[model samples]
Target: MTYKQEQLSEEKVFKDPVHRYVHVRDRVIWDLIATPEFQRLRRIKQLGTTNLTFHGAEHSRFNHSLGVYEIVRRIISVFEDRPHWNKEERLLCLCAALLHDLGHGPFSHSFEKVFKLDHEIFTQKIITGDTEINRVLEKVEKGFSQKVADVIAKTYQDKLVVSLISSQIDADRMDYLIRDAYFTGVSYGHFDMERIMRVMRPMEDQVVIKSTGMHAVEDYIMSRYQMYWQVYFHPVTRSAEVILSKILHRAKDLFEADDFTFKLEPTHFLSFFRGDVRLEEYLKLDESIVYYYFQAWQDEDDVILKDLCERFMNRRLFKYVEFNPNLQMKDWMELYTLFQQADINPEYYLVVDSSSDLPYDFYRPGEEEERLPIHLLMPDRSLKELSRHSDIVEAISGKKRTDHKLYFPKDRIEALTDQSLKKKIITILYGQGEVEDVR
Candidate 1:
């Protein structure tokens, strides 16, 4: 048998908390997992700064990637005998599921936001670039690496294959929802995944759910909504993320400043600060490396850098209050000016973080971010969009919810000797009794 057709003599199983067990029998998958690029995920936290809020939420991307692969494995097994499900695409789907999150950097979202990087682009690069992952994929077949990349990029010729990984109810989402919930000790993400998987039917261009499983799909959607508010977007997690982003911003600014000299050279971050990070450099800077820098920068000469690093390392997260940009523009301007007068850099200390979510939405062409609506296969060989038939889903469908919070160092403001300035800031911030000390 060719390398592409090779299978393990015995299946390798990973005992997983969320999926029970992840079984691997394909040689290509086993080899790919052994690659350094894949192993690097072990050091990268799945939830980033969320560990500070939920101590149990310390799982890694490695855990999530395997969970996704297992889910897709079970899904493809069901699809193998169904119409419109290509057996040739089985390994391709599994590969994409396992490696989908390959390019996530340390503190993934915050690093991407502060550095203007996209993990999806990096994922494609890792699969196609000069790397072990690319090498293993190339061994699968000529041009196979590009095929996997295309699947992840949502540009593959087979829309059915793409939907298995990228669609609204894909394996990636299913694994993360349950996996994250399991680790974080939250009940909001619980749902009947097995029911959803059993009811999944392959179609010409996407996967569909049988009418009998509509309630299961609804439960999954609602679970996702609750998980977003209860665990994923918890205010305490956001506070830590705010501080992390600020730290990256401060470090980058210091790196750009001619007069600023780091007592210890930021070797790992130099490429990131310069905006020319190569793949090798990107993979080397995992969460442990980032934490090392944060620890060292605590002793730096720059006060802002030192302070931000200290806050992050010690979890002295900034307090936050509900903020409405439209109604509080005057107060915001005044507060910005007062913070500057008090020698507190408004840029680093005062921040507004906004988070928004669209729990579920029907397909709308040409929209900025179009979400492909979930479809349920009817009893009479018909199809209907999920929200169209379910009143529970219809009520919440297409509704976008947004939250805005103003984060600032309340302790710093309270420490100011200027009594009048302190009172003004306090009255503006705490007047509504919205001050949240996410300690």
Candidate 2:
């Protein structure tokens, strides 16, 4: 048999907390997993700074990736005998599922935001670039690496294949929801994943759920909604993220400043700071490497960089208050000026973070980021959008909810010797004797 057709003599199983057991029988998958690029995921935290808030959320992308592969494995098993399900695409789907998150850097989203990088673009690069992952994929077949890259890029010719990985209710989402919930020790991310998988039907261009499984799909949607608010977007987690982003910003600014010299060279981040990160440099960075820099930078000459690093390393996170940009613009401006006058750098210390989510949405073409609506297969084999059939989904569908928080160093403000300035900032943040403990 060709390498592409090779199977393991005995299936390799990973005992997983979320999926019970992740079974791997394909030799190609085994080889891919052994690749250094894939193994690097072991060091990258799945939830970034969320560990600060939910102490148990220390799982790695490696765990989540395997769960996704297992979920897709079970899903393809059901599709094996179904119409419109291409057997040739089975390995492709599995490979994509396993390697979908390959390019996530340390503290994934924060790094992306500060560096102007997209993990998806890096994912395609890793699959197609000069790398062991590409070599493994190339061994599958000529041009197979590009096929995997295309699947991940959502540009593959087979829309059905793309949907299996990138659609509204794909294996990636299913795994992360439950897997994140399991690690975070939260009840919000649980749902009948087995039921959803069993009811999943392959179609010409996408996967659909049977009418009988509408409730299961609804549960899944609501679980995602709750997970976002209860755990994923927890205020404490956001606070850590804010500090992390500020650290990156400070380091980058210092790098660009001619007078600033680091106590220790930020070797791993130089490429990111310079905006010319190559694949090898990108892969070499993990949470440990980042933490090492954050620790070392605590002793740096740059006070802002040193302070931010210390705060991140020691969990001296900034406190946040509900902020409305529109109604409180004048107040925000006044606070920004007061922070500067009080010897605090407003650029690094005062930040407004906004998080928004649409739990569910029907298709609306021509929108900036169009979400392909979930569809339920009717008893008569016709298709209906999810919200159309489920009232629970309809009520929340198409409704976008946004939250805005103004984050500042409460400790620093409280420490100020200038009594009048401190009182003004406090009054603005907490109206009239409402200065309760934020933590």
TM-scores for every candidate against the unseen true structure: 0.99, 0.98
Instruction: Assess the local accuracy of residue 431 in candidate 2 as a C-alpha lDDT between 0 and 100.
Output: 59
Pairs that collide in candidate 1 are none
- Evaluate residue 329 in candidate 2 and report its C-alpha lDDT on the 0 to 100 scale: 86
**Using TM-score as the measure, which candidate wins?**
1
RMSD of 1: 0.8
Which regions of candidate 2 fall more than 4 Å away from where they truly are? 432-439
What is the C-alpha lDDT profile of model 2 across 55-88, one tens digit per residue?
Answer: 8999999999999899999999999888999999
Candidate 1 Cα misplacement greater than 4 A, ranges:
none
lDDT of 2 at 108: 95
Task: Residues 1-439, candidate 1: write the lDDT tens digits.
Answer: 9998999999999998888889999999999999999999999999999999999999999999999999999999888788999899999999999999999999999899999999999999999999999999999999999999999999999999999899889999999999889889889999999999999999999999999999999999999999999888888899999999999998989889999899999999999999999998998989999999999999999999999999999999999999988788888888999899889999999998989998999999999877888999999979999999999999999999998889999889989999998988888888746698777
